[model samples]
Target: MSQPPLLLTVGEIARRLDTKVHRIEYVIRSRRIEATGWAGHARVFSEANFDHIASELIRMDADRHPSTRSNG
Candidate 1:
């Protein structure tokens, strides 16, 4: 109970992020995010993976829109 989730399923990630399942898979497949390992038969993603994905997205957005960069 203290260890957090071992891994979140694709659907669970989508639910948490309020995005589509395909989007989640795309990030995982493209290596923008990572799946920790397999469990039984499912590809398992760490809770930290969402944080990683969020960071990557922010990086990408800043790269695409330089004007969004903070002046401070």
Candidate 2:
């Protein structure tokens, strides 16, 4: 069986998403997205969950900016 991907830290994810660490915590608390462990101490994200969160954010941004929509 294939091994699971490693978890991601809050700071790492925030840096990648170009957002504040607090925003990450807010998402976790609100359950807008699921994550593993706590923040600063043991916070981490699965590859699938991270991708899911990223996709959701992208979709939200697209919805906010109709001009960015593609013809296809």
Candidate 3:
């Protein structure tokens, strides 16, 4: 027998990201965020994959923001 894959529901993801369920749903449906899961109503996200995507998003956000340089 094969073990079930570790997957995260939309609600779980929302809790992790500290966002609302609607926002997560929006991201998933709009394809604004990268994710892998079954098609249709049985969608699920792998914890590893979601972590990777979230990390990338954080990095991208930091890159887009300019660093403040101060003269001593």
Candidate 4:
């Protein structure tokens, strides 16, 4: 429900998601999330990319935690 950043690094995304950076990288490598492009030596993600990843992770969390699931 909040606005996403214009761009972010994997570490920033991981911190925002309360996960580890390695997990973020894993998500990228596994194609769960897509990078927008490169920023210096780091990977960049657009607002759309972050939104997509956040939604996917939420869905994954719902799958892992039944209490978080919706009736619909």
Candidate 5:
């Protein structure tokens, strides 16, 4: 039998990504990223969602700090 895929909560993703939960929440609130599903009132994310959130965070950072972005 196949095992179920792992799901991560906001806190888990923030810990793994070395960021704050509020930052993740901001992205979600802005609709840049989305949760895979909900576990009660908490949002649950799949690996794909994690990757999307990570990339969106990076993009957000770059947008906020244009000088940090490479011209190349």
Candidate 6:
């Protein structure tokens, strides 16, 4: 039998990404990034969600520095 895939909690994801848990929560709220599951009140996410969160952070950074955005 195959085992279930591992899921990461908001805090774990934040630690791995070198960011604050609140930032991840903000991205989830702003970008509507859904959680894969839940641990009581805490939100849990899949690796795929991690990728999306990272992308959103990069976008947010670009938004804060328009000059760094690609012209093409």
Q: Which candidate has the top score in TM-score?
A: 5
TM-score of 4: 0.73
**Against the hidden true structure, what lDDT does model 3 obtain?**
0.67
Give one digit per residue, the lDDT tens place, for model 1 in 2-65. Answer: 8667687788878877878886777777775557888788777886887776565667668899
| All candidates: TM-score | 0.62, 0.67, 0.49, 0.73, 0.81, 0.80
Best by lDDT: 6
lDDT of 4 by residue, 30-60 (tens): 7657678898999899877777777777776
What's the candidate order when arranged by decreasing lDDT? 6, 5, 4, 1, 2, 3
User: Which residue runs does candidate 4 get wrong by more than 4 Å?
Assistant: 1-5
Question: How close to the true structure is residue 51 of candidate 1, measured as C-alpha lDDT?
Answer: 79
Tens digits of per-residue lDDT for model 3, 1-72:
998878877777778888778756765665555556764776678877577646654555566774732344
Could you give candidate 6's per-residue lDDT for residues 1-72 as a string of tens digits? 998887899889899889998998999998898889888898789989999998998889898999997789
Local distance difference test, each candidate: 0.75, 0.74, 0.67, 0.79, 0.88, 0.90
lDDT of 1 at 59: 74
Candidate 6 residue 25 Cα shift, in angstroms, is 0.6
RMSD per prediction, one decimal? 2.8, 3.0, 5.0, 4.6, 1.8, 2.0
Tell me the lDDT of candidate 5. Answer: 0.88
Off by over 4 Å in 3: 1-3, 20-36, 39-42, 68-72
Among all windows of ten consecutive residues in candidate 1, which has the lowest summed lDDT? 52-61
Residue 66's lDDT within candidate 4 is 92
Candidate 5 TM-score versus the reference: 0.81
